[model samples]
Target: MIKKVILLGMAVFMTGSIAMAQHGGPRGNKRGMAKDLTPAQLATLQTKKMTLALDLTAEQQSEVLRINTEDIEARQAEHEELKQMRLENDQSTNRAEAQFARQKARLDSKIARQEKLKEVLNAQQYAQWKKMNRHLERNRRQPPQ
Candidate 1:
């Protein structure tokens, strides 16, 4: 009877282990881990003054705001699509490709935005803006430790 009980317990334990393994983790929900931002939302967040650090005249500010809003929406849409591709692909190579594409697009967009911003600034204002952007970039790059 004791031997039979031991065997039954072992079978139950094995079945539970197999079930857990197939289900993956306690939560078992992929939706929570997926990227959720729409392009419009990301653009709105990006155009906010805290991140841009530019000093502008009223006209310059309006122009910059328009540029930022447009750029952010475009980039955010591209980013969201890339993120969806990454999530759908299980292969590391595919994920890497998606990431690379997303990064390239982002860099190109940033360069384009910089050029547009230049058209909106005088020499002194542009210099100040560059300085502020450099400071912001430096701050962003620091390791949290």
Candidate 2:
């Protein structure tokens, strides 16, 4: 009976570990490993995807690449800033104010990006880009099926 119990416990532990390894474990595949990518790599990949989806011309592609690079670099900087802010834990700062500021900044950035895209893309392409953004936002909010 002792031997059987030991074997059963070992089997359960092994199964749990295997499941963890397959499902991204603690470190997580949550970012799809995108957190590991450099800003330039992210920009290039995003621009290429947009080009493919929008059938962008050479000029438009270049413009979009620049926009993507700027956005990626800005986001990286903001991420680092937020990391530092979290580390500081300033008791003087209001958490609600910080949250509101962060959200407002993000919205402002999006609005600026949309304006830039509008200047670069035709009406049809702009519409398509908006549609693509909606789809991406939807997917980001939902867990994998």
Candidate 3:
């Protein structure tokens, strides 16, 4: 009986350690540098870059700033919502509802952004914007050297 009890305790400890290690025991993925910045700061930075890239007029700059602000706010809200969902459902695998909602939100945001950009940009600028966006997306998918 004494030997059996010691073995059971050892097994429990080993399992617990393994579980902790799998779930980012002491050094989980930290927030990236961009996440450390305020949403307003990020919006302003992105808007300025877009303005420079597209040679935006003052009116276009303001419009782009507004769109960037809305985009940043929505992204920040989604981040918080995802974090909350993770915390609440750590071991739950039934994520269909959450996944559906996330997908819908992403599509809705994309459509809204495209419409807003269409209204704000001339045809040539819109074409340039789309090309630049595709290039950025391609680069983003590539792993850093």
TM-score of every model versus the real structure: 0.57, 0.81, 0.72
Q: What does candidate 1's lDDT look like per residue over 49-124, in tens digits? A: 6235555567776677688778866865785676776687646566567679778878898899889988998887
Task: Name the runs in model 3 displaced over 4 angstroms.
Answer: 1-31, 90-93
Instruction: Write model 2 residue lDDT over 1-145, tens digit each, in one string.
Output: 9999999999999999998889778677867788989888998999999999999999999999899999889888999999998898765878899889999999999999999999999999999999999999998999765
Residue pairs clashing in model 1 are: none
Candidate 2 error regions (>4 Å):
1-22, 25-32
Each model's lDDT = 0.71, 0.92, 0.86
Candidate 3 weakest ten by summed lDDT: 24-33
Candidate 1 global lDDT: 0.71
What candidate 1 gets wrong by more than 4 Å, as runs, is 1-55, 90-96
| Model 3 residue 140 CA deviation in Å | 2.1
